[model samples]
Target: QQPVQSPQAVILREGEDAVINCSSSKALYSVHWYRQKHGEAPVFLMILLKGGEQKGHDKISASFNEKKQQSSLYLTASQLSYSGTYFCGTDAYSGAGSYQLTFGKGTKLSVIP
Candidate 1:
């Protein structure tokens, strides 16, 4: 099943912060985060596996909870370069070549001056 994302849109000023969340209906083996700018393809941000661990950089971070089938992306120190639509992709690994990953509609984040 496709994961559900919260806050369909977000507006922030430069140097602000925001949080985007995603939840899945089924047990997830991995979660992917991506950012897509206008008229562009999504860019890989990070991935969280079922190990209940977190991964990220100084400006972006993400957490995944295997038991809750949920994940959250944190955008700190927001910049104009960070303006884009964020998407959370969920993956279910059943068996060999029997896996599927789906993403939510996405969260539009606009950072203004």
Candidate 2:
């Protein structure tokens, strides 16, 4: 099953810090992180494997706990461009290319200067 994300919305001023968490009931093969600007498609942020391996774009960082089947994204010293809705996608192992992802409802983050 997909993970549930907390805090449906958040408001922050520039340079503030925030944390978003994602957790699943089922075992996860991988957890993918993404951020969507108001009018833009979701952009990949990071991917964390069951073995604790991580990969993704620069400027975004995340951590995954295999045993807990959970992940958290850390946003530090926020920027104006960081304002957006964050989503965590969970992928289960179904063999080979059969893996699929389920996204959380999302956490809306707004940043003000």
Model 1 misplacement above 4 A: 94-96
Estimate candidate 2's alpha-carbon lDDT, on a 0 to 1 scale.
0.88
Q: What is the TM-score of each candidate against the true structure?
A: 0.95, 0.90
Error of 2 at 2 (Å): 2.8
lDDT by residue (tens digit), candidate 2, 1-113: 65799888999999988989899998998999899998999998878889876543445678889889889888888899999999999999767779889999999999999
**Stretches of candidate 2 exceeding 4 Å from the true structure:** 53-59, 95-97
Best model number under lDDT: 1
Candidate 1 lDDT at 29 equals 89
Question: Which pairs of residues collide in model 1?
Answer: none
List model 1 lDDT by residue over 1-92, tens digit each. 77999999999999999999999989998999999999999999999999998999979999999999999999998999999999999999
Q: What TM-score should be assigned to candidate 2?
A: 0.90
